[model samples]
Target: MASLEQPILISFKLCPFVQRSVITLLHKKIDFTIEYINLRKKPDWFLEISPLGKVPLLRVKEHVLFESAVINEYLDETHGERMLPEDPLARAEHRAWIEFSTSLFNAQHQLTQARREETYYKIEEDLTKKLAPLERKIGDQGFFEGDSFSLVDSAFAPFLMRSQIVADNIGVDPVSDYKKISKWRKNLLSLPEVQKSVVKDFEDLYMEGIYERGGYLADQ
Candidate 1:
């Protein structure tokens, strides 16, 4: 077993990217401390650790790291959890899917806010069109990588959960319509570690953004 010090994670309670780091640590059963931050108003210590000024920065002993995917890999490597496979081709494929999911999210889902039902539906339509390919890709595979959960699963889970919330808020069920993808999402969320790690306040985040977009903003 690789030795690990108690890592410190600088994160935001509502960021899906930061949530990915939390999930991986939980999956590996690694003990760590969490320092929640406000991205708009970052803390002095957080900025000192990550000058780039981003949340989800992981500090292991004297070393610091950034980016959600990179943080997950660092956690796996340091803790010897092997969340990612050693096979080069398999690892590449996993990375591909993770990047693909992030790209799709950027294209269609990132800007969703409560405007009109039609506005949310437009996002749903874009996501639905993009998801057809993923649904076919899974085609009943229990996980993204063959039969076992891997790094790709960790990277993808946060986005799927966020998407589910988006669908719920919009009153349109993307996962429900996409059979294979829906099953995959269910399996990912069902992991005990995933449940423990993913932030629970995502719906409120959505609601806050939506309300703000609607010209109604409070201390949320």
Candidate 2:
């Protein structure tokens, strides 16, 4: 494994995956630098190191790690107390849920890109179905597993945060039908790590991006 030396996180401003890693880093109180890159015009050096040409790449000395889940897991294992459960079975369950949350992000992405109201509704319905299990399982105390914040909460925070932003801008709430999910999302959004994960102008930039894409929601 590569050693950390003022480790760097390569980011694209609106990337939820990158924001996930940022939340982990912040929650751990690790000292690291973030280098924002323009995804439209990725630099040659970045292209050389990033296998998938994606954001949320971690630069630890000469070693580079791609994929947000891998980067976040690496950060969790390398610094501070582990966010995952110590029990193997429980930890695996958490990992699976984190993977599930990634799918929700994809659905949200589709929702934002749907150009027709019909298409948008279809994507939304899919997202809602995906949240059904979470609505049943989210602990009443807060966070994913309970009162303690873990990697699962961080994994899902970006999607909820963006959902709220979209709702605030367009009056469409994704979790409205699921009371537990809506409440869970509110608590997730209030965390300091989640709050500080995005750029200072995130809401403006996010809304502007949706308009630029000319999605159906943009018209609202």
Candidate 3:
């Protein structure tokens, strides 16, 4: 086994994308340091190094890497047990699903930020429409591809975590009707790596963000 290189992950406390990287690192059991920064007040050094001015930038030795997906693929390729499949076609399918997970994340953001019942329900309907395919695709196995967890699970876990938190806080479950998603969520939440992927005050911070946005759910 190649020795793992310790990396510093530059992150924001509540970023879901950053959470994905954190979960991947923790799942791989890699040694890493996390540095939180205010996105509103990014330092000159961070701005100089990050081309896209995004969180979840990985600094390994002297090399700085950006983009959560790219960083994750690099990490899986270089260290720990392989999270991606070995077959070329299977690997490509997993990559596509990983990309699809971003749409779920975006839909969740829209749903959370919606201030009106009409908008909220509309986004919810759209989200359900989006999830229908996934509900059909997901099988009896616990994780995305099967019994084993993969990069796809890491990519989608943050959205599931946040959705549950929002549902708990607002008393509305967006994913209640999706049986497969509900089951997959339970499985993901049971993992130690997924449970420990976020900051201690994650729920508090998430609710704070929702309240700050003045959404309908926040009022409820």
Predicted structure with the largest lDDT when compared to the true one: 2
TM-score of candidate 1 on Cα atoms, chains taken together: 0.83
> After best superposition, candidate 3 residue 92: deviation in angstroms?
0.7
Candidate 1 overall Cα lDDT vs. reference? Answer: 0.73
Task: Indicate the residue-level lDDT of 45 in model 3.
Answer: 83
lDDT of 3 by residue, 1-220 (tens): 1222679999999999999999999998988988889899998989998999988899988888998999999999998789999999999998998999999999889877898999988888888898888888776677886889899999999999998997888887767798889999989988999999998899999989989999877777
Displacement of the residue 191 alpha carbon in candidate 2, Å: 1.2
**Residue pairs in candidate 3 whose N, alpha carbon or C atoms collide under 3 angstroms:** none
lDDT of each: 0.73, 0.90, 0.89
lDDT of 1 by residue, 113-208 (tens): 424565555665787788877877764775875787788788778777766765666554666787877878888878897788745665787666
Query: Could you tell me how far off, in angstroms, the CA of residue 12 lies in candidate 2 after the best superposition?
Result: 0.3
**Distance from true location, Cα of 163 in model 2, Å:** 0.5
| Over 4 Å off, model 3 | 1-5
TM-scores vs. true structure, each candidate: 0.83, 0.96, 0.95
